[model samples]
Target: MFDSMDEERPTASEPAVRRSRSLFEKHGLRATRQRIGLAKLLFSKGNRHVTADALAVEAHAARMTASLATVYNVLNLFAQVGLIRSLAIEGTKTIFDTNTSDHGHFFFEDTGEVCDIATDEIKFAGDLEPPEGYEIVAVDVVVRLRPKSGSVPFSA
Candidate 1:
């Protein structure tokens, strides 16, 4: 049964907005219209992953004439600020994530769809250690994909 403590957790949406602003401020980033708009697009629903091409389409649909270069720039800025994470989805293109927390990803082999897998669900074996003074900052796991239909999936 779910306990009252579990029921009281804040909705995921709240943190995205709060974190967006805080991150911008923390990084001394100017709160430009383009930046805020992009932040909302990336984090509005709270840490969902998306591709640059997909985001460009969404921006275009919103009547925002942002060039691909601009999109890339903003993405890089966001990434630098730790406001989002980026991953190169195997057999596809790079994707952006608003969830900055440590986590793993899963690629639906049949659909080429990428999704986050809980970090706790992943177990590492062996005594692999980071070389002397180096620290393991982050880990990214990408699952290569293929469609079961025996037909190639469309790429963006």
Candidate 2:
């Protein structure tokens, strides 16, 4: 929402702010100025995904006055509380997702972008078997996509 080209963005309410602060406390994280600033910038936009770099940029623009390192630290805090989930786009670039549920994503190859795939749009089929002393966990699907016209050719 912060770095996106969307014309409008949603805002978080005072109650949400209070809840966010409480969440930090619940997770044993200090409700510092920087943490609160980043939380407000993040939750205010509703359920959306954003890269850490993009979030750092937005935090500064919003007058949060936090460094990239600090942003990553704060993000890790929220993630620990189950407020967000991280999706590794590929071998590099981890995107922080707000909607912490079982769902797939569509990765745009053209712009290296991603968005959640509606739950009813796709179906999953698999039989998981865990070895002894191991437990089967969640299954995440990442469907990579190329532009309809055609994928861009190689560059020099």
Candidate 3:
């Protein structure tokens, strides 16, 4: 998978790598080996999100030896490039999203896991306006939840 690209049509991964490089270059970021590897890891899977701790474990398992600080730096860099989005639920641990589209999240309180919720499933009927200088970019709704241990609650 590490084959070098030619002048003609490149491999699937090559285009992605080129796009990532362009994004990094546009954002005034110096593309490095670690940053490229981290970007590949983050964009390899579709519809996947992960926490820093989880990413560190994956990196260790893959024998990549990406330090926690390096992971955070890579994540921040990816966020800066508009390649991923970060969410901090309840002022706690932050999670990184691979899907950059407008969507919401669901936090499983019992497991402390986060999942993406489609934007089409939700509807807002009230007039919403942004603040003076800043325009509303995206909307994220995180529904705190817990697994049904026994019977589902009436309110649920």
Q: Please list the Cα RMSD from the true structure of every candidate, rounded to 1 decimal place.
A: 6.3, 6.7, 6.4
- lDDT of candidate 1 over 72-141, digit per residue (tens): 8899887776667888776447788877666777777666677777767875422558899997777777
The lDDT leader among the candidates is: 2
Regions of candidate 1 where Cα sits further than 4 Å from its true position = 1-22, 124-127, 145-156
Residue pairs with clashing backbones, model 1 = none
Task: Please report how far candidate 2 places residue 105 from its true position, in Å.
Answer: 0.6
| Candidate 2 residue runs with Cα over 4 Å from true position | 1-13, 125-129, 148-156
The models' CA-based lDDT, in order, is: 0.68, 0.72, 0.70
Candidate 3 lDDT score relative to the true structure:
0.70
What digit string (tens of lDDT, one per residue) describes model 3 on residues 51-84?
8888888777777868999999889777766667
Error of 3 at 78 (Å): 1.8
Clashing pairs in 3: none
Candidate 2, residue 24: the lDDT equals 69
Off by over 4 Å in 3: 1-19, 124-126, 152-156
Show the lowest summed lDDT stretch of 10 residues, model 1. 1-10
lDDT of candidate 2 over 18-44, digit per residue (tens): 665666676677788888788778867
How many clashes in each structure? 0, 0, 0
